[model samples]
Target: MFSIPLVILVPSAYGRMLLRLANTVKERSDIHLQIFAAGNDWPLEKVKEMTEAGIYKGFKPFEQLKSDFQQADAFLTVMSFEKAEEPFMKTSFTTKWLDYVPYGKPVFVWAPDYSTAYQFAHQHRAGIAVSEDDPVALVKAMIDAASNLETWQAACGGARKAAETVLNAEKIHTLFVDRVNHVCRQSQDTPNIDDLKELAR
Candidate 1:
């Protein structure tokens, strides 16, 4: 059986959910998961525990991390599924998404339906979006992506297109300038307090 290599870079605070994901992946034989836990918040003891348990492959240095991502078959990014995190999840986009876009690999977005990551994945068709909180659902998404080579290739192409079009630096700069000019025009068109008072009289 051929195993698909999936790489994920973990931020400091998301370890709890990450552990759940790791454990779930461990039970599966088709997906080989490698996690790079980045930042100081991940305690050394906890890292050792997960490593010994075979769920974690240990922290990779900066250079090796880039190499691993380049070699991996696919990428994964996640947002918190908790209700308390809804506001942040909906409004903010993770830099991980941007990083994965350049890799030209399929991304598995495990997040709530309302999350920005989920919406972006759906809009671009660049990856599989699993809005369910279940780890099983995430694993199923991985299997589906690995099994369908045609769809996988299409997703890879979509990612590259997204980078060239919507995420392009020049396009973003122009959009920002246009927004600022529109705001200035709206401010100029609004009536002043003195104008309103005179009209009232």
Candidate 2:
């Protein structure tokens, strides 16, 4: 009975990966799939292709993102499926994952085995992480998320906790300010490198 949308908001850099994931879930009648353009650089053809294929409603911006996400049945976060991008995946966390967490929605991430985002999701119990190379695994996660309300709610609670504790904007900014202040204090106490070199000679 959860007939809302499964939303994906991406920066337009990973159109092919989005398409692959959308295609896997296109046929579900229980929910619709929507891809929202996060930034301005999305490929026009890829957008057109998804629309034509009926995998996604279309690429567009929501009038109110928070409200839109609140209404969504679930969320998606994905990384590139290419083996060449494995190094990037291993080190990076997608912004979409952070954005989705605060909404308390069940998130599905398709990422490489070594991805930090994948590991974080699994560790925090915040979302479901599927191997990017395994379409079946992605499909199964989707179905499992869609079919079970209790599990979905539990994931949402975990995601909300993660957003509040680790990814909160205030906490991150405070940490940044503290680090900056520490560096400034250290610089004030340390002798200048040029002075040290001159003294050595």
Candidate 3:
């Protein structure tokens, strides 16, 4: 379906408002909403504390990563990939956006100015995004996103098509074969390698 699925990729009590906002988007826009993270990136000591306080939603392991990616028509990453700029960015300097790129999902990042993934997605027709840190802006972006599922799906499809090339098993297999060939060539180059081995024996 062209209708976008809204998936929150961050895990925190601070994210509750976003979760509440997702309910609104679902009612108003027909988008599905869920929660996810690559793993319990949050500290283990805080797990029970967060869940007990109703601050945590759920966690997905690397094995289940593919399903989690598929569950969302869109992914939200709250980190920044920009560094030189300070005031607009504050602290984060990483791309949470990369985690979802393999799924080829549309990404919505509350990111700093230099988000290469956001810019790339914008250029590739993967999804729409917003700047500024206002939570209201996030909700509005969600509303706009609610209707752009068709566009989001197209981008995701393209992303999935390219995932295999980047996660190439055969290319990895070729590397393994090349290593064996290199070792064989080295053995052949060694003069009296077996003779020396026999003398030692």
Per-residue lDDT over 35-145 for candidate 3, one digit per residue giving the tens place of the 0 to 100 score: 444334455655554455333446556566666566666666554323434443453333444456676666666544455444554555444556655656766776665
Report the lDDT tens digits of candidate 1 across residue range 10-115. Answer: 5543666777777687656777776765432456776676677555765566666677777878888888888888899999886666666777878788889999
lDDT of 3 at 175: 88
Worst 10 residues of 1 by lDDT: 1-10
* Top of the candidates by TM-score: 2
**How far in Å is the alpha carbon of 12 misplaced in model 1?**
7.0
RMSD of 2: 3.2
True-vs-predicted CA distance for residue 168, candidate 1, Å? 2.8
Query: By TM-score, is 1 or 3 better?
Result: 1
Off by over 4 Å in 2: 1-13, 38-46, 52-63
- Taken over the whole model, the C-alpha lDDT of each candidate is 0.74, 0.71, 0.53
lDDT of 3: 0.53
For model 3, what is the alpha-carbon lDDT of residue 70? 65
Candidate 2 TM-score, C-alpha based: 0.81
Query: What shift in Å separates residue 99 of candidate 3 from its native position after superposition?
Result: 4.1
